[model samples]
Target: MTLSPLVFAALIFALVVSISYAVLVRWLPDPGKERLAQLTPGRGSDHSTLWSRLQKRLLAWLLWLSPWTAAMSGGDEETPSALRVRFGHAAWRSPVALQIYFTCKTLLTLVLPLIAWALVEISPWHPQGLQRFLPLLVGAAVGYYLPDWILSILVSRRQRALLHAFPDALDLLRVCVQAGLGLDAAIERVGREIRQARPELSDEFALTGMALRAGSSRAQALRQLSVRIGLKDINALVSMLIQADRFGTSVSESLQVHSDALRTQRRLRAEEAAAKLPVKLLIPLIFCVFPSLLTVLLGPVVVTLARQLIKPVG
Candidate 1:
């Protein structure tokens, strides 16, 4: 029996999906190994899989396709460094990720306009003259900046997560220090303990702990942590810790004070947001709710008046 076109198409799609899934499974790293490597530092090397190598090559080709654009936007010393810093702030530390991001931006910027133009040509409402070019231009502009917008959103979310977890991490650190753990040990313990609750903060702390273990000074590790996080609270905490270490002050006391201050600031922020709720709602209330309400209440009256006037004229 012959299959219908729809059935044939569905079978083809299912085959494609299954093949893709199989390839992904083969190429992906073993999650168990990855987790083990993360938990136990220096035990195993993170070797690149075949899939990762292929992906890197593809991204390189994409970059090579638009050398001028990549050079102008990301290849320069200043631009690459800034992009790396931005990636770190967003918790994405891979340099190759930046290359991939630029590659995607370039492809989108070129491809979207072509796709838009093709769509316009095939559309039933065949646009004429300026309309034909307008969508293409708009699509190109949007595609060019889409990566930047996505990166900004990622950075904001990461920063917000860091902010939300900061006070809790500080409290944990203070407790650990008070219980006689060294600062480095306390950081490691905090990272391990907070892994489930705040993965972002835990990762930062884990990196700082690794730096400390790798023979970096406390001040240097803390400073690098501040740079990676790019948060005022973390910077101030790093400075405070450095000062406390230099002056032979108690680490626990400093941490406790900072944690309390952070909590107060967080509360104030919450209150400020609550206070702005009414103002933010005002626009929706006026434009949406008020219009619907007025239509409902006055619509019948207007209809009745119109009927009465029409009857008199008749």
Candidate 2:
């Protein structure tokens, strides 16, 4: 019922920070104008509109120091960064937006753990300090990478959704191709048709079409498509397309086969996940569900037995 000193302190700190952030945002420059300044690494503006500038600076500082930010910028040795694939062409054209993202992430990393620690400490079932701190540490780590993890998850889910929709897209493309459209035109038409339902795949296909229109070879466009989407299925599809283009094969037949193969792979993946459910459930059953069941079933017996034994002893 009553808040602890620590909880009160955190609440106060949060309120002050919120108010400060509001005041900062009220009078700031559009980070878009200063985006290059932030990216270029120079003596940045001392002030943007005033409030927004501080927010931007705070964000820049956070981005400058965050583990996630640092990790994002680093290159993978053999495999190119998936982040680059996903976001390489995204218009992160606003410095303020970038800073805001980092700031939010940093606050999540810090505040969630503190709130978690407070909740754990105050709980009637509060475990030992070691046990409690373990959760806090886990919460902190989860919170820190949470955004990137969510982004990765969204990308994964989007890819799955696209894979699911790929058959329809492919069928449409085949129709277009059969109806006298060029390969590129067929892809463009299919991309447009599926834009709403399979934005992830549609966007990549559109971009591929754009690349081809811009005079990139079909192979190059397909390769770029594979790079942008960053999925094994898409990569395989791209390779197939490239090979078909190179060896004078039937694009429609090749696509039809690939679509069927993708659907099969998706089905197999679903089965695999379903098979994993029992293994995943075992831990919770053992650690959580069983204990509660044991308490309910044996608790009264234990109490009665204890009373019987204690009475005889007395």
Candidate 3:
């Protein structure tokens, strides 16, 4: 018997996919050549390699498929500056990383629906037209939004780490300044000393130092730090520093005051979280723990009462 139209279509699709995979595997350069090219230092040597040319062509194809990738990647006037700042806060500083992110989004958006459709088609259940397309829509939507969710998680985690490190960093800076070091020296010293305890904060401080050393004004560097951190507290601190620098105020005294304030704020946050713990636990207790407890406590008693009440009449 001849195959149905749907079956014929599926067989053709599978053949195409198989052929594409075979071609790619056979044509792509070996991993050894790629590594050799990497080891060869000069651009001329690397670019001349077969693997490098293949890699470039592959990258070009991906870029063509996702032409909007570079535009959304970063620094586009149309793209929100806040998003670029968020990427910095998340420690994804490479310009190419944004392109890779958008490329992933594009690939997922295109690929997931096809996969969903193929799976639905091959299943014994044989979903109807609308039902078959439903998974495709869902897959596309999820694929599109997944990157944003992942980025948000990264930003939140980094912000929390920086928050935890800030007060200690402030204390270190204060001590260094009090010992007669200049502001830049105090910052650099704090960065080095706090590296073990708070790597994220140390990195931020180190970057700020680098910017300062590269001849950027202190105010400009501090502003950049605030942008990188994307924190209100850092913004406030940057503003305070700029003001102090303008007026020639004692840096040590300012740091000391800020450090104390941060400590107080941290303490208050801890206390607030502690106070909310019981409330947070209430739902779990009612839904999970209480049911188990009630069953354990009343189960035997209910059983005995049931037996007594159901006694047979003579």
Which candidate has the highest lDDT of all? 1
TM-score of each: 0.76, 0.58, 0.74
Report the C-alpha displacement of residue 16, candidate 3, in angstroms.
28
Q: Against the true structure, candidate 2 has what lDDT?
A: 0.73
Best by TM-score: 1
Candidate 3 segments exceeding 4 Å error:
1-77, 114-131, 311-314
Runs with alpha carbons beyond 4 Å of true place in candidate 2:
1-83, 89-155, 304-314
Per lDDT, what order, best first?
1, 3, 2
Candidate ranking under TM-score, highest first, comes to 1, 3, 2
**Candidate 3's error at 115, in angstroms?**
5.0
lDDT of each: 0.85, 0.73, 0.83
Better of 1 and 2 by TM-score: 1
Query: Candidate 1, which segments miss by more than 4 Å at Cα?
Result: 1-80, 124-132, 312-314
Q: Kindly indicate the candidate among 1 and 2 with the higher lDDT.
A: 1
Model 3 weakest lDDT span, ten residues long: 43-52
**Candidate 3 lDDT for residue 250:** 79
- Which tens-of-lDDT digit does each residue in 101-203 have in candidate 2? 4556677878889987776665544577478688678778888888777666766676667667777787788788778898988888888888767776687
TM-score for candidate 2, residues paired by index:
0.58
